[model samples]
Target: MTALPDDLARALDDALDRVPASRLAPVVERLIGDYRGGVATVSSRQGPILRTDDDAAAYAAYRMPATYAAVHDGLSRAAEVVGRLAPRTLLDVGGGTGAAVWAASRLWPSLRAATVLEGSEPVIALGRRLATGADDAAVRAARWERTQLGAATTLPEADLITVSYVLGELPEPVRETLVDEAAARASTVAVFEPGTPAGYRRILAVRERLIAAGMGVAAPCPHDGACPITGDDWCHFAARVDRTSRHRSLKGGTLSHEDEKFAYVVATRAPGQHADNRVLRHPLQRKGLVTLRLCTGDGAIADRPVPRSRREHYRAARDTGWGDAWPPP
Candidate 1:
């Protein structure tokens, strides 16, 4: 269908620059190398999608900015919704170029240190470039903290832990371990998935596991004890990313192509840590014309801003800004 929203088109034009293609090239190759190997071709609305086997996966990885940002924004907001909770340490699992971590850091400057834990040499190397400060003489020998996560190992207990857009990528057993770890160690945990039905199912699975373990349910409010809103509706939010800094290849005027949508759940072990849906509902839901539901037994509803029409309402979904937003400065 359409590619992205108009605002996102403008944002990606700049934001992609931050992770320069020159930098992304190598990392993309590594991340997709195995999956693409021996494949003759891949298909999409983007034409033949030609690749000589080895290049397919890398190419696919490059095509995923919208999907990546969708889940990232969902988790980032999870951190923001509860900022009043004052978490001291923030841990980003499967951080990926530190996108979500940087998002949280900006919202919670009180954070002592932000640790982005990821595996993947080139990608993590790219992440280090952004989070690690200026380098110099003695610092010349310095290296960034990029570690491989394992089932046996224990992550340093933190007030917040986020595993965004990564559940789909992990093996079943490892995913189980990561979830269990978050339940035991983190004060709050938020995870997200695309708004697709399959994604909603996965988020539900996660919600059940975490709640069973004692964490309180937060987003996508559990409707009558069931999640994902019973209708064709989805829990989605838009992230506005600055364009030029992100490096945009080409634009077709409006970002009719970029639409990032996802379902997210926020859970916390500590009492009073859950975020009231009102803070978020005010921004996304329509006032008077619309209603808000915390996805709970009560299914609370309230008035908020709703776009002029269904079309405009859909268009208003915006989130992160790359750095500079429009017209590529």
Candidate 2:
């Protein structure tokens, strides 16, 4: 589970306080509709979805926590491999409201510099305001550049680059170009998307492009040959996000927490310690047996059952959760 830092959460709360939820509810609803209906076309001329300050506020209040949680989970997995590398800089493309920047700063305190590239003026304004309250100096001073994604776009060099929840909005060519540019510019790149079938497809495409760009798959996949997942299934994981009062109110939900299901891929110039097998889902525990669905190093999905007779392995299995590496690495 990943939760927003207290300072970041308070900053968001304070920002939301400036605008009443009652005034932002309809804007949030419209944004939700735009998300569901697809906000962008292949044409680069299409403007950003967030057109007003209220729209940006609604997004920051309602969507930032979930996006932050998802990006944090993805970055944690990446850190499992690249923690020792000690990345010192970050570049967040399409970083709406700096969610990815906050997640990165939370994971890698060594980060001394960060740059955010976003297209929307209102989104950038709100992002800059929220960043002023960030505890991480790098995040607070991050440069919010107004750059649109297209064929002619060039990415800045950084130790790490993150693209989250933005690829699905662009055309295929633009997405491919962005990934290729990131691969060329950064030592590590992490991309995140919603855990839908379509989102999974985008991630798969990104994984392929990254591999083709001479980078190694750093997390999720142990080997870089081919993805084992086939048919209707897709590779994704869930992060539990603790909702704030404002979050719940904006979302109109009673649940105190929500699971943010996400699909992501981390590729790096240098390979890290890849997991032997990744637990694919929540372990099913029976009276005396635990069943584990694993994606193995050889690119195959298998169900491994641990019975009580095997005390050591059973106990380990009992303690394991979804998205963990098997054998407790």
Candidate 3:
């Protein structure tokens, strides 16, 4: 697992000072219940959900680490496909606790300013506090705005924009409105949601809408046509995050690491080279052959075999991990 960004690591440590794991455990458990009971669903009409101060603190402690890691990885992979890009500004819509901005700042030091738009007061307060001690001047001074999402909402033009883990909580009309707004305001847009089938469906819908809006598919998908993945299979990726002792205590987990599965799409206004194939599953090596399931550039799924007789390719396949662009380096 990759280490958390130094500033974010310090920020999280600072937050832990205000809300210890002991005080955060019950909130984490309650949230788990809400999720399991299917009561955590989002609606467009709903106001700021994390009402209490403790609720906001607990959420930041438990969720921020995994989300930061996921968004960081997503942006890095997207950069690989899009080549060199230096964005001057960023807008993070529905950016609870500002995880996406922290990730973006790490990747794009060229960004002079960043803004986080969120409705929850407690969450926004916590977000401001989290960045209060950051080493980066831009991140430390990032603007946090109290804003709602809808057709009436106006967005600031930015080089890159991210809407992470927020779309699934909105109604269809609102979701469409936000996507359209994002496409209009930014040259690059990235959306992320949970790894569930429902989440994948949301990503697919957003992908189609963005393409229709004249944005090119930049990563994960090689082409801008229809997605080849169908029922029971969703295009998602896994990122391993090391859990702190406090994290383990809050969630009552025995493992030292957790795999966060997420569905995401990064779209750009201009066309770029995409990988010929994306590794859909972990490679399996048996005897003299290695097998890989890949989403080909032509928008079809293929099970490719590389045998030992094909020495160079066989070694490459053996080292390939899931979610990596294929024809491994």
Scored by CA lDDT, what does every candidate get?
0.50, 0.87, 0.84
Between candidates 1 and 2, the TM-score winner:
2
Candidate 3 residue 135 Cα shift, in angstroms, is 2.9
Off by over 4 Å in 1: 1-83, 133-146, 150-153, 220-224, 231-235, 250-257, 273-329
Which prediction has the highest TM-score against the true structure?
2
Scored by Cα lDDT, where does model 3 land?
Answer: 0.84
lDDT of 1 at 56: 27
Q: How many steric overlaps are in each model, in order?
A: 44, 0, 0
lDDT of 2 by residue, 1-329 (tens): 68789979988888888997789888888877777676643353366778789989998987899899989887787677655756799999999999999989988889999999998999999999999999999889999999888977889899999999999888888898899999999999999999988899999999999999989887777778788899999999999999877777777889999999989898888656477788999999999999999998888899999999999999999999988888776
Can you give the lDDT of residue 74 in candidate 2?
A: 77
The candidate with the higher TM-score, 2 or 3, is 2
lDDT (10s digit) by residue, model 1, range 20-50: 4655566455544532342211221222222
Query: Once superposed on the true structure, which residue ranges of model 3 sit more than 4 Å away at CA?
Result: 43-46
- Lowest summed lDDT across 10 adjacent residues in model 1 is found at 320-329
Report the alpha-carbon TM-score of model 1 versus the true structure.
0.61
